[model samples]
Target: MALLDKLTSGSSTPPDTSGMSKQAKLVCELVADFNSNNLLTQIRNNNRSKSDIDKTYKYPDHFTSELIETKNFKMELLKWKNSHNPYVVLQFHGGGYVGAFKTQYRMFAGLYSELGKGASVLSIDYRVAPENPYPAALNDALYAYDWLLNHGYSENHIILAGDSAGGGLAMALCHYLTDRDRILPAGIVAMSPWTDLTASGSSYTENFEIDPLFGNTNESLIYNSVYPGNHDLTDPYISPLFGDFTGFPPMLIQVGSNEMLLSDSILVAEKAKSQGVKVRLSIYENMFHVFQMGMTLMPESKKAWVEVSKFLEQMMVL
Candidate 1:
């Protein structure tokens, strides 16, 4: 198949990338080659252990790293200089509810600190599935939030962000908060979030053969692991694409035009808008899932983080 035909196939409209950065396109090709081993699937089927997913990036030495112990888990806190009302971004790492703590997450914490004005960052090493299932991670996230409040950080100081499964978790945390009539956070940032575990989105199949990490395979390796002894797939706390956004905070959602979860971000953006929530949605041309992780390596990724900065500034001002 010609390159143009491959570009136009099953992606969102226009599919035009004649003007796209050469580096962005290069990363796409590199990603395809890198994922040829099906690393994610190997982890899902227990062919690989969770320890294999704990890759870390070499981040700045200025930020302090601490393990905040809770009765159930240890939360990682990455912070620049500490001060009263210091900007805080509570993050969750994505691994399809299985993968955790990747190189990109550390990069994001550093980026958030620089962009968010010396922001303090926190990430929960939430429990994963085939071991600890539904409500476990969600419960851990709730504990993290309450832990912040009890320690004197206002809800206004926090902006939740995540990528892929972690992105869905960020939104689901808000759904959990709103339902309980708790104070909501400052905002949310999601990158190629997997909002529907059922793989109900048209893009799930439309982009199947093209999605570098998740194309044309048994999706059972996904939600089946996170929600094995399950409730309904559409349950707001699990899928979050079916979640409530009324009274939710401002949001920034970014997705790749080429990812299978493209529809996940689009659907949630529309839902949040309908419910009168503030929303900013951007779809990058000819990219892959969680491509923002490559911000250190690609212009498109850097561009997406710039959008995140603008949104964070706007949220802080409001």
Candidate 2:
């Protein structure tokens, strides 16, 4: 059955992990009660610097990630031999604008590369906030896109993608490039994008109790301080949901049903569709944030990736 159908099936199960794989249920149970306040505190104090990107991240054994350095940050470019147009996914890693999980992003890039049937993946280490603050990440994203363009990758052959804050950055990058008349990517793929920094979405209150992450907690508020670094929560770049998507590229957004950020993804899809952008959204039933990152045994994760593969194929054809 289609993922969207799972949501619309109207089943009235009361369990939070309904429709989740047993493995996904376990994963959700682990984090549903957890909060990242301590972790954020450590990062804020610089006790947990993103040094893990170099020493801690393990690349998938299937491919080698080429390290490319810009003036300010390093990027991992995982190239695959495409069977069709030479395509690339310029990706961003999510850590709520403060955390850096290069290894996780590398693994995600591996999926994009494989699912894309040889499309290359270029994942960047954009500067995060509290240490780097707003606009820093966006600036680096722009540079990464430009690097691809300069290296012979056409805008239409490139896609912007990321999860969590990185996902929001992907959308915001389109806004920046679009406003400046820079070339936009062929499409966008966001997994539980935090597009609304304002935290104003109704989901914040609706899913507050059930969300496995950031549920009924102040963890997101900490990010507000360390990331946005200002009171301008509604800024289009800060919160891309407020940005115009009149001419943006096709977008594929996948979000878990129980995520507090569910509204973030849904609102963006509605806006994009209203503006005539082709959008495909899959709200996995009772799943949590970025459930695609869960263990491989999870059926939802695999299906979500299959959806990604399908989207990439369609983009190439277009």
Candidate 3:
């Protein structure tokens, strides 16, 4: 709590990188290395069965990871705790449609569940690209949303959220639902969303050097090919920056200043505001992509979690 307070309090100096300690840096680097080597290619291949893929990554304690087959596709769910009638927070894991799953985002689910206080956090593992492609993942998200609704969860008690690609999908799902006259969620949260499938954001170039995760242009190009092929990348459903924000539920967005996707979040916020949608955007200075993953270690990350929790609580009251 003290650490969170200190982080929330104003500080002039950039977070003391010197105090990061050798062990912490090594741990972060090791995680990054493991992700880059093993998981990156595995996700891109998209050849492994769902069970085989689940076996590859490590999940945190207390998370019940399981596969639930919906009507059209199979979706993986990561439940943080046992609950009856808990508010449902359905999260989509980020991988640019190629990388992460419930295991990689288990920590996020745990933090959200803890802060939400009696809420249930479920991270959805949708099909990836170069195989499943566009509309497949989007369809899976809609199916998951429908499943929640059919299982006795009310739309007013549900929150949709995700990071990176999953973040974009959350927005796209909302658009699709709204178009189909489905009930909107209570709220939405996106962490560093990649809103522009076209990769048209100026920050993509400006933040390239500072962003540790997506520094290489070729890697992004390769990823773009897998998901947005033959589709109009600028289509509102594909690039949410181009979507209609009218009549959507309240939204909270958090993005790191150093990420290549920074502009994507900014554009979405601006568009939402233009349409009079209630929106709150927090830009964390000097933080890397999805810095919230460092909540266990970094003060900034913990502060972000608290802010998101407060925002969701307020939305629930509306």
Candidate 4:
């Protein structure tokens, strides 16, 4: 309770991280001093053009990316040579449904190469909200999946992955496929997913100031508002936590204990397990939202991806 109060009140006193590794403790301290909410606000107001945003970053050299443009949408294929398996990951990069970063896609490609047995990733530049809300992203994700299927990838050879909002999108896509009786992917990997658009999770309030990325529930809610349009916030399409997962594929969800979205991942994992879905949930101690963003730099990030790879391998064996 003292640690909770210390964090919630923004006290300079550090929390009792006795059990955390030195690196994890350092990360916690660094994030505690950061003003992530202010950064989020600035990004929301920047209004930068796509080209301008694209100019800020580039894909990493570990993988090669090829642009595939369509009449309605564009996608990129992140390929690594000498892959160990035949798996295709359809990635939905997270940006609160308003924007995405090229750097994140490159990191995803790195994840695929390291933990996924050199699996190729198809990163979709799905439509975002406010400008393109609700069904637009859903439609684009479905189209990308169909493209994969039509291009010779069997349903069993494919896996779905996403971070934050994209994680929710991946799950929604699975829900859509199940409802319509389509074949499901082999498995799904969600990293710090925002499963509840209604912002009903307890961590929203309890972990507000403690969460280094989101900072508070309202910040997440602002992003949520632009996407739902007139749709019900609790609609299973928007909040997959409310949906039934009777026949869903095996899933692995990773979230940081200090994140405001912690409860979102917890509740969804419970829901999936109740409906007989194979679910693996990892809660990293002393970490923040989407801590995997640090990737190779953070030990927790490396461990998370290793778990993801193990999960993928297990699913493939089933």
**Per-residue lDDT over 1-318 for candidate 3, one digit per residue giving the tens place of the 0 to 100 score:** 233344355663435432333544564465456446746646644533232324554454545666676565555555554554358789888777755464546667666665565467666667767667887788888888888888788899899989888788899999998898888998888988878877778888898765666654446532345777689888877888888989889999999887788999999999899999999998887666777777646656656777787887786643
lDDT of 1 by residue, 1-318 (tens): 121122223533432333457777777677667666567545445632243224444456657777666786667787775533366889888877765455456667777766776678887777776577778778888889888888777898889988888899999999999998989998999989879887788888799888776666664345355543557888889889898799998889999888888999999999999999999889987778888777645657766766787787787743
Cα lDDT, all candidates: 0.75, 0.78, 0.72, 0.76
TM-score against native, each model? 0.86, 0.87, 0.81, 0.85
Candidate no. 2 TM-score: 0.87
- Stretches off by above 4 angstroms in model 1 are 1-20, 38-59, 82-85, 219-224
| Number of the predicted model whose lDDT against the real structure is largest | 2
> Which whole-number lDDT from 0 to 100 does residue 111 have in model 4?
65
Best by TM-score: 2
Error of 1 at 15 (Å): 16
The ten-residue window of minimal lDDT in model 3 covers: 45-54
Writing each residue's lDDT as its tens digit, candidate 4 over 1-318 gives 221122234443333433566777677667655545568456654642142223334554556667788766678777766555677889988777777445557656656654665677888888776788898889999999999999878899899999888899999999899999999999999999988988888988888877766674464543446888899988777888888889999999999888888999999999999999999998887678777776555556756766776787776643
List ranges where model 3 is wrong by over 4 Å. 1-67, 71-73, 76-86, 221-223
Q: Which pairs clash inside model 2?
A: 129-133
Ranked candidates, highest TM-score first = 2, 1, 4, 3
lDDT of 2: 0.78
